[model samples]
Target: MHSAIWTAVSLFLIVEGLGPMLLPKVWKRGIITLISSPEKLLRRFGGAFVVAGLVIFYMVNK
Candidate 1:
């Protein structure tokens, strides 16, 4: 279980790094867009991700 958690985290790190590593310009543009977006919208978007992650985690564990 410990290693499973670490493995998931490691994969997440790799995936999170891919945006900048593969297309830095696009990533920068995305960041700029996000910066310009409304705080409420960003919070909602982040909240959605958190909910989705929780659902996935629950399904995986079950």
Candidate 2:
């Protein structure tokens, strides 16, 4: 059970990270449009959320 969950989470993060890197223009455009009025604090917080979520998911599954 745990192995399956970890595999899924790992795959998800790999895909998420790779998608933007592979298509920088599309990703950047989307980000700009989505967070046009974004604040630095919010951006940092969003990143923290992603990292924390990934960490939690990995720890639990591991």
Candidate 3:
């Protein structure tokens, strides 16, 4: 479980970083847009994504 979690985190980090590494300008624009969004809106979006990720993880593990 520990190894699996670590590997998953590593892969997620790589995937999250790829867009910025490949297209810095677009990534910067996206960051600027995100920065301009309301805090509540970002929190809600983050909550939704967390729920979705948990559901997918449970489904795959089960």
Candidate 4:
């Protein structure tokens, strides 16, 4: 369980790093846009991502 958790975190970090490492400009623009976005919109996006992640986790485990 611990190893699986660590592997998931490592994969998440790798995926998160790729955009900034490959296309800094695009990544910067996306960050700026996200920063400018309304709080409600950001919350919705966050909620959606969490829900999606939970669903994927269930599917994978099942």
Candidate 5:
């Protein structure tokens, strides 16, 4: 379980790096846009991701 968690995190980091690595200008623009977004909108977007992740995890485990 511990190793599995670390592997998942490592994969996530790799994926997170791809945007900046492959398309730095686009990624920077996206980061700037996200920075200007409203706090409430960001919260809702983050919450959606959390819920979706939880659903995916549950389905995979089952």
Candidate 6:
């Protein structure tokens, strides 16, 4: 069970980490334009997902 939990956490981190790091380079101008918006909803949404994932992992492990 612990191994499975760790595997899931690791996978989540890897998948989430890759996108922001990779996508900006691939779509440099587009990413810049998107982030520049006054609303910035996407950043907030992504941050929420990351926080939720971390919280889930913490609860499961603890």
**Top candidate (TM-score):** 4
* Overall local distance difference test of candidate 3: 0.97
Instruction: Give Cα-based local distance difference scores for all models.
Output: 0.98, 0.86, 0.97, 1.00, 0.98, 0.81
Model 2 quality (TM-score)? 0.47
The TM-score ranking, best first, is 4, 5, 3, 1, 2, 6
Q: Give the alpha carbon lDDT tens digit for every residue of 1-62 in model 6.
A: 89997988899799877866878566677668777866768778789989998899799779
User: Which is superior by TM-score, 1 or 4?
Assistant: 4
lDDT of 6: 0.81
- Name the runs in model 2 displaced over 4 angstroms: 36-62
What TM-score does candidate 3 reach? 0.91
lDDT of 5 by residue, 1-62 (tens): 99989999999999999999999999999999999999999999999999999999999999
lDDT of 3 by residue, 1-62 (tens): 89999999999999999998999999999999999999999999999999999999999999
Which sequence of candidate numbers ranks them by lDDT, best first? 4, 5, 1, 3, 2, 6
Q: What residue pairs clash in candidate 1, if any at all?
A: none
Off by over 4 Å in 5: none
Clash count for candidate 5 is 0
- Candidate 4, which segments miss by more than 4 Å at Cα? none
- Residue 32's C-alpha lDDT in candidate 2? 84
| Model 2 pairs whose backbones collide | none
lDDT at 52 for candidate 5?
Answer: 99
Q: Ten residues in a row with the worst lDDT in model 5? A: 52-61
State how far residue 29 of model 5 sits from its true place (Å). 0.4
